[model samples]
Target: MTRKLEGQITIITGGARGIGRGIAKRLAADGAQVIIWDIRPEYFDSVAAGFEPIDTMAVDVADPESVATAAQTVLTTYGAPSIVVNNAGINGPVVPVTDYDFETWRRVIQVNLDSVFLVSRAFVPAMVEKSYGRIVTVASIAGKEGVPGIAAYASAKAGAIGFTKSLAKELVTSGVTVNAVAPVMVETELLEQMTAEHIAASKAKIPMQRLLGIEELAAVVAFAASPECSCTTGFVFDASGGRATY
Candidate 1:
């Protein structure tokens, strides 16, 4: 690693486990002072054991108040983060749209989509003032090509992608880049939220006939979060293993 993010402050939401955890480690390794905003900060110690210490704050990214408070604390303590990864999300129940519980649908949207808006809004001002920033959202292949059983999850992710593009354009001249990474199914604890049948179906869509690796996804996110990715904003980097046509 070239320490491309040296002297930068980075934040990763949902950094306690799964894809978020992997990204957190990668950013830390890349020489950013990494801070994790997760609902389960208890898992932070375990994730930080062999690496440089990472700051952790218990945060419910979906709640406006929680995000506001956390954002205040970070700005007060560490100044504005130069890198923000909107990786917190939930895989809503695996059910058809007609059978989906209404409350669950709202909850999914809140966590996966609404949080992106709140978190970005909170930190972007400081980033604009500083004249440098990177925002990366962890989206999914389901966002681009819908999945049958997870309508809520898919819809929220699609919204995230759109939000990234729109925000990127809004900040284009401000030196703040907004982008997203859309990966195919990865073998993470999130898989526990899906049905065995759903898992099989998802894997079958990939020409590679395999699940994406956490490290692979992390690598893509690292680049998007780095200064080297200077020319691209409002772009969705694909990690679909030949599954994506566009």
Candidate 2:
């Protein structure tokens, strides 16, 4: 009777709530020691309540120094993480690219795209040295189809997907795996970024004709972040409800 991720050290960013929290719960339930990294400390109390042996760190994943400090703490406290999930992201305001606020666009890219780069770069070397790791990033279908209004969000996720592929190749022979999950409209707090009309239109385009459930998404991510995910790297697994898969 062995759990798949027993004793593995896992880091889950944006794990305080929503999809990230779901992934943390799944990993912890499977015997992994979970560390939740997020921008808000308040959510940590609520997040820590549902699980045992889970710790939280207030981290600004978009900042290099913050990520570096957190990385050091992780290395010192529990050694290198065996699994890293770059799941923190934001869906910026739904607005046409032509009229989108410049600063907002940059902020979106920094958080959604740059944070993945910063967080992974900080811990990947350690993972390589250990010669065992799983990196799962959350991209979006908007990245594939350029979902009109949310150009910044789409562009950042596209960068995330590309980053995952390139990083996967870099560590392909290092016994580390990197993959991205491209999800369609997911039912989470992130949806608040969209208008009612936007949400409805997005849902209409899904082949499943509905938003993806958080638990369902968590299952796919958990599989991608496990030791059992031995043969897949540099690939994007589709969780878009058939919205777009190639």
- In terms of TM-score, the best-performing candidate is 1
Worst 10 residues of 1 by lDDT: 45-54
lDDT of all predictions? 0.92, 0.89
TM-score of each: 0.97, 0.96
Q: In candidate 1, residue 225 scores what lDDT?
A: 98
| Per-residue C-alpha lDDT of model 1 across residues 125-237, encoded as one tens digit per residue | 99999999999999999999989999999999999999999999999999999999999999887888889999999999999999999999999999999999998999999
Most lDDT-accurate candidate = 1
**RMSD, one per candidate, in order:** 1.1, 1.4
